[model samples]
Target: MAAAGPGQHPGNRARLIARFGPMAGPWHDALPTLVDGLARRWGLDVGEAGGGGTSRVYRCRRDGDHEGVAAAVWLKLTPDPVVATQEAEALSAWSATPSVVRLLDSDLRVGALLLAGVEPGTRVRESGWRTADVARLLADLRTAPRTRTPLLPPLGERITFMYDMAARRGTHDPEVLAHGRAAALGLAGTGPADGLVHGDLHPGNVLVGPGYRLVAIDPRPTFGDPDFDAVDWAIDGATDEVALRRRIAELAALVPGMSAARVLAWCRATAPLTTGAPAFLVTPAGLRG
Candidate 1:
């Protein structure tokens, strides 16, 4: 487990560069020095670098023990200080819970994090998990304690960004995007701010671990309506309305306050603006719903 930088994957470098636009070239140039510095300081033997879009990750091992457990960690680095600080705060808040990956170490100044590694870390989707199983995970995550940190952005801000992006790109119908913005604003005022919501929860984000049956990793944590998290499964890459309806019903039942209507609103609002074919964004007929 030796430290490696982000230059291995040329395609990943391009994708990252595209993600950052004008700042990409300099960001790419800076990765090697940053990665090496963190590895040395933390005594981390970092492996292959992974492309995490907003951040970079590496499979790492350190010479240490934690309560009789060997030190295996995932090292992540982000250029944005805001994202780095918020993520560290979120992980710290949920350190006591087994449902989420623990924060082993952090250096917010460099936007680096050392996260506990999950054994046999298969993604939930690759593990052949059913929809109900995912719902169960969301329900459990909702029980995790809230953060006292004041910097966590409201979920509405994310929705607004999508809506605004779509509007500027003119790739989505304005009417539909407007509906989503309104719904997000309305829901923000009405929905329950029950507990900490893994703002980016989806099948890919959940992993099957040896210690915990299903655990979440790489959270964009926020304090908000648990329903917002619940609806992610319904609208993400939905192709069939029949199946989508079933998932919506199931999720609403699994997490209280996540009604079909509310979830449907989220789909209609965020779907068209989403990257892939979101469940309710456009029908198979190529018409905006």
Candidate 2:
């Protein structure tokens, strides 16, 4: 096979160039060649390329049987080497109890990771997310970290990034976005750090693995406030305050050490990022943002 690069996919190169600018052009242009190299180095039968997030993802299969690891695997390659390194560290920390996808191997220098594939690969949102399942996963996540990662950024930094990006997009309500960012930062400043926060734990990031288990992927990890991660689930598909409140209560009750108050705070603070769900910014009772 020859090195195809992003030229094979007409839109991908343009998207990468737009997002990461000229510096990303060489990387995208060389991606296919790099994929070929990875397949050779890691014994992978690389399949079709995928488009999502900040990474180039591919379906793959290991050539040899490995203990515990599945034959079917997924490879994530990114342009940012540091992001890849931190992602590996985050995944490794979450792999003991493994509420997230299992990390098989990684090449941090190349910003690549080989991951165990989910059997069905169904996004929980598409499957109609259940609060209980999310609660279970969140609970397990608290105990998932058998290793510590001191280098990970805090939740505040991730929150700042989201608000800043929203400003650049010029889509979200400025008042709401600013309020959300400030509130979110306050929440991040104080809370239990039992586990690493999966900074981007929206429904798209949660997938159904084998045994109908809910596993998370693509963590933009933060080291503060696990409850901050539950905001997405609390607000997911909730069109009104009653529904949001109910979900928050259930999640808080089901997940040990989860605080309903904190989750609500997070939801209010991050509502602008999700387009303010109902314009009240995920209201609860009389209080409104």
Candidate 3:
């Protein structure tokens, strides 16, 4: 699907300012020059635009390569340079993990990243995700950095932010607040920062890569229990206990060091934090507060 280039896409400019505000005004105003500079600096022949929300990605190729000779690449530019720096750190740590896209080069000064474009580039949401593939992607990301770094904060912090935002928006379901809010809060504070996680590994963030393998992209990198990453996958398109439990079982069995019980708890804890809770979540027992 072709996308409208920057400043052309409807509402994208407002969303951009709303997301980064005046702090990034200079960068927003200089987008064209930035793209040209990046193309020259990286020896890329910039092509069409793609990706949305918080970043803009352009499909491009190396300087003299034709379509069939050299692999195409993506230029991911972010409104916030900090996000680029942090993701650069996370991607470097996971460079050996084939499930992640290789970060060819990054210019943090301009909040831009040159990333390897996936073959077939089909989003999992479009192709459908298999539990085993999802688990493999999760397991591949379980690598723990030798020393804990601030680049990866605990997954709970991300959850807290989501919960706080939901609360601010007054979007919580009544039953959810009555039953799941306590669960969400408790889960937010649970655990040691054990391993690396693609903190926001939703279906849209995944794509089919070479050899028909699933490749993860745009990680909201975080640490602590890999199980936290499983919640989104477990609940995606799952509208009942039967479906969700089945996913939890499949993912737990395949993901190293993960358990069905933990994944379920995380789901129960987070179901309310998210706006659309599947009908079967029913709020765990004793979570009243």
The sequence of per-residue lDDT tens digits that candidate 1 reaches over residues 220-246 is 777776666665677554677776777
lDDT of 2: 0.78
Candidate lDDT scores, in order, read: 0.70, 0.78, 0.75
- For candidate 1, report its TM-score: 0.83
Q: Is candidate 1 or candidate 2 better by TM-score?
A: 2
Better lDDT candidate (2, 3): 2
RMSD to native, candidate 1: 3.4
Cα error, candidate 1, residue 182 (Å): 2.5
Candidate 2, residues 141-206, lDDT tens digits: the string is: 887553446678767778888889888997665665666677778777776654588888888888
The runs of at least 3 residues in candidate 1 whose Cα sits more than 4 Å from the true structure, single-residue gaps closed, are 1-3, 6-14, 17-24, 64-70, 168-170, 235-242, 256-260, 274-280, 283-289
Candidate with maximal TM-score: 2
- Residue 167 error, candidate 1, Å: 3.4
The order by descending lDDT is: 2, 3, 1
Q: Pick the candidate with the highest lDDT.
A: 2
